[model samples]
Target: MTVLGIETTTDVCGVALNRNGVQLDSIVKNEKHIHAAQLVPMIENLLSRNQLKVFELDGIAVSIGPGSFTGLRIGLSVAKGLAYSSHLPLAAVSTLQSLAYPVWKTIPATESIILSVTEIQRDEFAYALFRAIDFIENHVPDFHLITKNEKETVEKIFENPLHHFLLCGFQAEKFYSMFCSENRNVSFAGKEFNACSATSIASLGERYLERNVIADVSSLEPVYGKNFIAKKSNLFSRITQ
Candidate 1:
C-alpha cells in the first residue's frame, strides 16, 4: 500500500511517502511559519521525483492538531481536500501521538513516560505524556497546555519517580534545564529525534488503515487543544471609569 503523510504542527512542514509502512521519500523544511505555502509544493515535488501521481496514493495521513493553530488547519485542509478529491481514505493523527510514536518504537517496554513537548507560545508549551507499554501500544493518559512554571511541572515529574521519562518534540530542549535540575531519571531525546516526522505519520496511518480507523473527510476538525482566547479590549473600562 502507498500513502502520503503531511505534518505542519510546528516550525517544520514535512511530507513523506511510504510504501508498505516504510519511508520512500520525504521533504522536510524548517522555515518560519511557511507551512501555508510550502506544504503542497513539497508534496508535489516528492511525488514528481518519485514518478508518482496523487491518484496513485492509497491514502493520506495528516497531523491534526495541538500544535500551532494555523499550522493544523493548513495541514488538515490539504489532507481533506486530497482525500475527498481522490476518493481515498484519510487518517487523522494527533500531532503529539505522531511525534511520540517514533520514540515509542525505539524504547523497550519498561516502566517509563514519554513526554512530547511542543512550543505553543513564548515560555509556554503543549505537552503530552505517553506511557510506553510496548513497541505496538503506548498509552497517552494526558496532555496539557502549560507555562514556564517550574514548580508545578517538577512536582508532576516526581509523582512517579520510578518510571523513567523520555522527552521529545519541538523546542524540547527548552525544558532540559527544568526537567534535569531535580530529576535525573528523566532524559531528553537527542536533537536528531526530537522533531515530528511525517514518516511516523505514514507508519501510524498504515496501521489505522488496516484497522479501518479512518476519518470522515466531510466533518473532520483540527484538535485545537484549547479555544483561541482573543485579547479583550480595555477601551470600555477606560470610557466608563
Candidate 2:
C-alpha cells in the first residue's frame, strides 16, 4: 500500500511517501512556528520529487493532533481537500503515538515503559505512557496508548520507575526534571533520545489501515483542537461593531 502521510501538528512540518511501511521520500522542517506556511509546500515538494499523484496513493494518513491549533488546521485543511478530491481512505494516527516509535526504537523494546509528553503551556501538559513490553516479545510494538496527564496525577502514578522509562517530546525535558525533583525512580532521556518522525507516522497509519480501521473523509475532523471553542464571554466582549 502506498500511503502519503502529512504531519504539521507541532513544530515540525513533514510529508512522506511510504510504500507499505517503508518510507521512500520525506521532507521535514523543524523551524519552530512555521507549520502554517510550510506544511503544504513541503507536501507538494515531496510529492513532486517522487513524481506521484493523488490517484496513486492508497490512503491519506494524518497526525490527528494534541499539538498546535493552527498547525493542525493547516494540515487537516489540505488533507481533507485531497481526500475529497481523490476519493481515498483517510487514516488518523495519534500525535503521541507518532512520538513513541523513535523512542521505542532506541530502547530494548521490552521491560521498559515510555512516557511521552508534549507541552500544553499554562503550566500543564499532555502525556501518554505505553508499555513497550510487547515490542520485545516479537509482536511488533502492540502497546496501548495510555494517558498520564494533568501534572500532579502522572507524578503520583509513576512514583516508582523501576521499569526503565524514557521520556521524549517538546516538553520531555520539563517532565524529566519534574520526576527528578520529586526524587522519583526515573531515568533520563538525552538529546539523542527521540524526535517526531514522518516515517513513524506513516508506519503507524499502515498498521491501522491493514486492520480495516478507517474513517469517512467528511467525518475526518482535525484532532486536538476540537475543543477550542471560542469562549462565549470573550465573544460577547468584542461585539461592539
Candidate 3:
C-alpha cells in the first residue's frame, strides 16, 4: 500500500510517501509560520519527485495535533481535501504518537514506557503515554494538559519501577528535569526524536489502513488538548457595514 503523510503540527512542515511499509521519499522543512504557504507545495513536490499522483496513493495520513493550532488546521485541511478529491481513505495520526514512533521502533517491548510531550505554554505541556509490552498501547490514550508543578500526576504515571521510561517530543528535556531527574531507568530520546515526523505519520497510517481504522474526513478534528475558543473579531462586520 502507498500512503502520503502530511505533518504540520509544530514548526516543521513535512510530507512523506510510504510504500508497502517503506518510506519512498520525504521533504521536511523546519521553518516557523510557513506551513500555511508551503505545505501543499511540499506535498506536490514530494509526489512529483516520487513519480506518483494523488489518485495513485492508497490513503492519506495527517498529524492531528495537540500542538500548534494553526499548523494543525492547515495540515488537516489539506489532507482532508486531498482525500476527498481523490476518494481515498484518511488516517489521523496523533502528533505525540508520531514523535514517539521512531523511538518505539527500536526499543524492545520489555516493560518499556514512552512518554510523549509538547509544550502548550509556559510551564504547561500536553502529554501522551505509551506502554510497549506486546505492542504499543496508549496507556494514557488522551492527551492531558498539565503544568510543571503537577508532580503528583506525573509521578503516578511513572510509579512502575520495572518500566523503563523513554521521554521524547518538544520540551522533553525540560520535563525530564522537572520530574524524572532521580529515576535510574528514565532517559531522554535523541534530539532527532524530539520533533514530529511525516515519515512516522505515514508508517502508522499504513498500519491503521491495514486495520481498517480510517478517519471520517467530514468530521475528524485535531486533538487540541483543550477547548479551542476562537477570538471573535468584527472585521468582517465592519467591512460589510
Candidate 4:
C-alpha cells in the first residue's frame, strides 16, 4: 500500500511517501515558523517528484500531536483537506510514537523502555513512555505535560532494573541527563532519532492502514497535551482598570 505522511509536530516540516511500510522518498525542512507556508508546497514537490497523484495513493497519515500547537494544526488541516477532496482514509499517528519508532527498530534487547520527550513551551515538555519488547507498546498511552524538575513520575515508570532505558525526541538530551545515573541502565538515542520524521510517520501509517485503523476526518483534532491559556496583555489590563 502506498501512503503519504505529513509531519509538523515540531520545528521540522516534512512529507514522505511509503509503500508497504518502507519509505519511498521524503522532503523535510527544519526551520521554525515555516510550516504554514511550506507544508503544502513540500507535499506537492514530493508527490510530483515521485510521479504520483493524490488520488493514486492508498491513504494519508498525519501527526496528531502534543507538540507545537500551530504546526499540528497546519499539518492536520492540510491532511484533512486532502482526505476530504480525494475520498481517502486518514490515519492519525501519535507524534511521540513516531519519534520513538526509529530507536525502537534499532534496539536489539528483548526488554527496553523509550521515553519520548518534546518541548511543548518554554521550560515545559510533553512526554510519552513506550515499552519495547517484540514490538513497541505504549505504557503511557497519552502524552503527559511536565516541567523540568518533575522527574518523579518518569522515574517511577523506569524504576525496574531489568529493562534497558532509552531517552529520545526533541529535548531528549536534557531529560537523559535528568534520568541518567550510575545505578540506572540507561542510554541516549542518537541525535538523528531526536527529531520527528515523515519516514517514521509513513511507516507507522502503513501499519495503521493494514490494521483498518482509520480516523474520522471530520471530528479529528490534535492532542495539545495541555490547556492553552492566553495571558491577558498588560495594555488590555491597564485599559480595563
Clashes of each: 0, 0, 0, 0
* Per-residue alpha-carbon lDDT of candidate 4 for residues 94-177, written as tens digits (9 for 90 to 100): 988999989888877566778788888877788877877744334126678888677776677767788777888987877676
Task: Using TM-score as the measure, name the better of candidate 1 and candidate 4.
Answer: 4
TM-score of each: 0.87, 0.80, 0.90, 0.89
Candidate 2 residue 155 C-alpha distance from true site, Å: 2.5
**Per-residue alpha-carbon lDDT of model 3 for 129-208, expressed as tens digits?**
78776333351257788897787888887677777789999888888888778777778987878888999999988888
RMSD, each candidate, Å? 8.9, 7.5, 5.4, 7.7
Lowest-sum lDDT 10-residue window in model 4:
232-241
**Candidate 1 local lDDT, 1-241, one digit each (tens):** 8989998888889999999878899999988889867787788788889988888889998888677878777788778878877789998887787877888888877777787877777877777778777433432235777777755765576576577888888778886665555676778877876787888888888878776778998888877777853222221121112
> What is the lDDT ranking, best to worst?
3, 4, 1, 2
CA-lDDT, candidates in order: 0.77, 0.67, 0.81, 0.80
Indicate the residue-level lDDT of 162 in model 3: 76
In candidate 3, position 37 carries an lDDT of: 76
Question: Which model scores highest in TM-score?
Answer: 3
- Where does candidate 3 stray beyond 4 Å? 134-140, 229-241
Q: How would you encode candidate 2's per-residue C-alpha lDDT over 1-241 as one tens digit per residue?
A: 9888878777778888889667898999988788756676677677778887777788888877677777677677677667667777777777777777677777774768776666545434566667786531221223222233444655666666565567776667776665434544456666654466677777777777887777676666655623764111111111111
Cα-lDDT of candidate 1: 0.77
